[model samples]
Target chain A: MPGVKKCLQEAMAIPGAIGASIVDYTTGFPVAMTGAAPNEDHEAAAAGTADVVQAAQSRSLFVSAVPHDLLEDLIITTAGGYHLLRLVPTDFDSRLVLYVWLDRLRGNLAVARRRMQTLAEQLVV
Target chain B: MTPAKSPGPGSLLTRVAGERRTGALVVGGTPGGTVYLAEGQVTYAESAAAPGVGELLTASGRLAARTWQAALDAGSAQASVGRLLLDQGHLTQGELELCVLGATYDAAYFALAAGTAAFHEGVRHWLGDVVSIDAAALNRESGRRIRLLNEIIANPRIDTAAVIPVPRPPRERVTLTAAQWELLVHADGQRTPADLAQLLGRAGFATIQELRRLAALGLIEQPKARATDNPDFVRLPRMRGASAPAHRHAAPESPAAGVSIDLSIDVPLDGDPTRAAVPAAVATSAPPVSTSGDPPAERPRLDRRKPGAKLPKEIAAEPPQPHPGTDEVLLKRIRTALRALR
Candidate 1:
């Protein structure tokens, strides 16, 4: 959907956003992305992110008292930046996960979270 | 023997066309490669130079040895293994096609590289395919010079003769498709990619593709041949349960006893007494009967009630039919006759 592109662009436009991608959770495929990589290997990145998401999901299932479906978002802050994975379920078992790489220095965790929620709600998958 | 100069596109095509063989031909260079297979041709392809098709399939969790063997037998008898698996509903058409393409490409890539080292026409090796590929298309897609094949052969990584095991990354994770998971579960580490494909009822190409993908992900490493052993040989990990001997024995025994005594024997009897009764009656009635000599009793008839059959019968026996327009019909007939005569 054009909305996905708009959402990704909007996410990227955020002050500290380094890169953003819309990933399909089921197949671990990238539906859309906005970023620059040296190798330009978006497929590999999407696949890698998908794997990370799966691991996180499995971990949540094992450790948490809450049911698996309650898992909404995962945030990993690295020395370079913050990696946010937001799972958005749609009409079918098909799910959309918005992956945002935010520069730690400029990124406001609160604002990014709010913005991601708004964007995820507005996203028409 | 040193690999000869990489064949020109024209020469590769001519060779393929002249041979009129059906199977994928892979051309590798700096970037990547391509594969092409004829309708009925078979190819031998391996990934990581260590694990062959069987190992790849089993490692991927795709198929069990017994199940894979059954499919292989069926495939051999059927028209094409790829097509047969699809028809048997073991794999989807898309999966089959992908498997075929992937296996062919992987095999061709290794085979061409190996072929360059020591050229032999008739002697069949188990690692790569015998089919030819469209060399021009491969070079064009990969965007590499054809001459690079000769140089690539010199690198021991690509050479079958060296048999260096590709190093596997520790704690690396991979997201596998359902079929890939099945292959890995069944791998038990012994079967090669080709063997796994046959057992899993998957095409060779698909198994190889998964192996390559897994290798790229660094989950599995290729095996290296030792100085004491044959240089060209590659070894895969031992089967899944090989290391845990006690667990292997204990695991199967518990499951076997529990399942056999608890579920297998009791479940059907407890759940469907009728099913057990029917079989028992059949067995008791024919003690010394030859299973092949006599046809089995006819399968229990299904309740064959046609969709609207009951409705029609109900409607038919309801009551006397109504003659709504008898008087009107008689009046209309009189009027029509009068009009016609006039």
Candidate 2:
């Protein structure tokens, strides 16, 4: 099992990555974060993203036809970067989302999403 | 060796971490909380004042209680309950950590608050250590939380007492966030913020924060010291007989009193308005015969004005004659008494 730090390191290594964090969506705390500048407010980002994830999950209640699994990853594209969040399913609680902010010019959304899923699969804690 | 007397929570934790002691720091003894430390690091903390990780998990709708119990049964022999839950996909590692983090801090707040505590060596929690936090760091965080709470809420003790909701009049509506609404719906007069949190399956701290916010907004009230809290409560009732005539003669041209009379006159002089205004005016205008100051004696009278309480025909119809001081008092008492009667 890859530890949180190791997982974050690998996530940060993704092409065009600006920052990455394993966030606990339930409490909005980042378990680990890397590749962000000193001034970057990763905690605020984690909390804001957790709210987005919660809002998305709440939508599952109204939209009965689509299963929750279909929305495995939530992607938000900004002018300068791409923000990708993938849910990490676990045995106990699945309220975890791996968040990675990528430079739009250097990152490929398709590639980052696939890599994050693989990395999240190996996360132990 | 006898332990030092009256050591602060931080020093006690620092000493424990220095020795790298493993076991529980039991605070407040019987039905007290335990802060589980592993080699001087905090592995877990629990308090009777706060809910545990299991409660939080189930309350959050993340795990069923029975499933958790079954996992406990299965993992009991190996001391790997966390692992069992993990293996069964109850929650992700990050989620577990978050729960642990929140629960630890929640419990620690109460544990450290107890101040006087004892260390029990070699004790272990069945769930095992999901993650470890430095005791010193935990202490600092707890302190920071206390300070933050003080900043947000004037009286932190609202966490302990039952929060009676003071419903506003239909015209004077208050807006609430979803979380605040949930809290309000669950806030029966009997439940303290802590009790409400337990019932709602939310973080106790968050619930307390909401209570404080509500208190600041005059939405929720602590039952303690209710009578004297309002300056008007003390002054208004006495303004009756003596002060009434004296004020009427002295300030005949008073716009404030004139506005109040106008407001009362506009009350259609019908049904309950005439009756309501006289007694209310009398009740409020009557001079205080004695200042004995027993709250219980005043409680029933004050209770009538509570938000949810049925407003007497006159008081409801005529709105108290506009003595700003008396009006302010009337408004406050009404809100204070508006408990969710159930």
Model 2 misplacement above 4 A: A1-10, A22-31, A34-37, A40-105, A108-125, B1-5, B29-32, B74-78, B88-92, B169-171, B222-342
> How would the docking of model 1 be graded?
incorrect
Tens-digit lDDT string for candidate 2 (A1-125): 55566788889999999999877675455655787832487767876887888777656453346445345888999898899999876543235788999999999999999999898777633
- lDDT by residue (tens digit), candidate 1, A17-123: 97888765534555557885214666566667777876866563534664553557878887877878887644211345888888889998888988887777555
Residue-level lDDT of model 1, residues B1-342, one tens digit each, is: 323486633345336545755444443332122234343233333333223333334434554545545555555432344445445665443233233333444434444433322222332222233232344333232222223233322223222221112234445665565555665565434445544544444543344445545544444443322222222222222222111212112223333342332232223333343344343333223333234344433311111233333322211232222233223323433442342232
List where candidate 1 sits over 4 angstroms from the true fold.
A1-125, B5-36, B39-55, B77-79, B114-135, B139-231, B234-342
Best-performing candidate as measured by lDDT: 2
Model 2 C-alpha lDDT per residue in residues B1-342, reported as the tens digit of each score: 213476755567778888999988876532246788888889888765566677677756678878976886787566678888888887666567756776777778767764467778988776788888877767765775676568766675576655567646233767664568898887654455655665566666667766777777778753332212221112222211211222222323444544444333323322343354565444443334353365543322222123344444433343434344334323432432241010
Query: Lowest-lDDT window of 10 residues in candidate 2 chain B?
Result: B231-240
> TM-score for each prediction?
0.31, 0.60
The interface root-mean-square deviation of each model, in the order shown, is: 13.0, 5.7
Error of 2 at B175 (Å): 2.8
